[model samples]
Target: MKAFNIEDTAMILIDHQVGTNTWASTTPLELLQRNVIILAKFAKGTGMPTVLTSSQETNVNVQGPLMPELQEILPEEFAARIKRQGVVNAWDDENFANACRNTGKKNFVMAGVTTDVCMVAPAISALEEGFNVKVVCDACGSTNQIAEEMSWRRMERAGIGLTSTNAIVAELVKNWASTAGAIAFPLLT
Candidate 1:
């Protein structure tokens, strides 16, 4: 598999709201949580810029954990890379696309709720744009197991890479003594 470097990467977290926790069916809640946490921890430990967003958290039926690892691990003043439109697919959001353009980060590590839409959409978009996309499979949640599987299949066919949280972080680090290594190694285990 192709390995990614830290300087070439960015992390995007989508719609991990309180409501998602209550209704996600594409995967078990526990697996989703574990992957999301892994992405959050990896981003913070490596200093990768990350974008966190919700789809009307206040209005949606989905509910996410407070002080999510996304919030907790990141610097208190972390800025949003982008806040996307409430559309199921994030590629529809200009701001989000701009964020990716500005970062100059070729490798995109993405996780989101409603995997078929949020995850698949941007992944396909990024691939079309010639960006290296890695979807953190366990990190994104959906409405049911079938949907989750289908989303993954779609992205895979589109040339988006599939990775687990640990592998992605390890690829970014690429060495035991790298700066991210110092912080990420402890967190990985």
Candidate 2:
């Protein structure tokens, strides 16, 4: 497989919200949040087209609001986030799917609250749709280790690639002396 190119890749962040954060157990919430913020910063610095989605965030009792730092980091993408009513699979939500399609990107890098649900569903859907998909494992979590491992296997079986936040960042940036690397390197520290 070819390395992810900045021009052809889009970042898709799904249901990384306050309510879902409480259910994440496979990965620590702090590490998940930090990894996601790192990806968000990389996308923003590189001008990558990104899609941010939330599932019923208004119903704070259920899905609560998106991570506040996302708003502060990628303000424009956060503002344009597709707020789904109750779509379990973000790809099933027409608006979220359309936002991703509209980016004109063939490769997608994704992460979300629960690996088995929020991340897996859409990642597989996108792969079936002929898009090259990769999930940032460190940036995603699940309620348990079994669920997380199962989701990773499921995605791999379906031809979706698995990667880490740091790996993706380094792959895209290539070298610290380059412009993108210069912008992304600080976030790793």
How would you encode candidate 2's per-residue C-alpha lDDT over 1-189 as one tens digit per residue? 579989899999999998897788899989999999999999999999999999888889977999999999999999999999888999999999999999999999999889998999999999999899989999999999999999999999999999999999998888889999889889998
Tell me the spans in candidate 2 whose CA falls farther than 4 Å from its real position.
Answer: none
Query: For residues 1-189, could you state the per-residue lDDT of candidate 1 as single tens digits?
Result: 477888878887777765665456766777777777777877777778677666555564444342355566665513563444356666667776777767778778888777875678877987898888888877776777788889889999998888878888788888879778887788777
Report how far off residue 65 is in candidate 1 (Å): 8.1
Name the weakest run of 10 consecutive residues (lDDT summed) in model 2: 18-27
Which stretches of candidate 1 lie above 4 Å from their native place? 63-67, 75-81
**Clashes in predicted model 2:** 0
lDDT of 2 at 85: 89
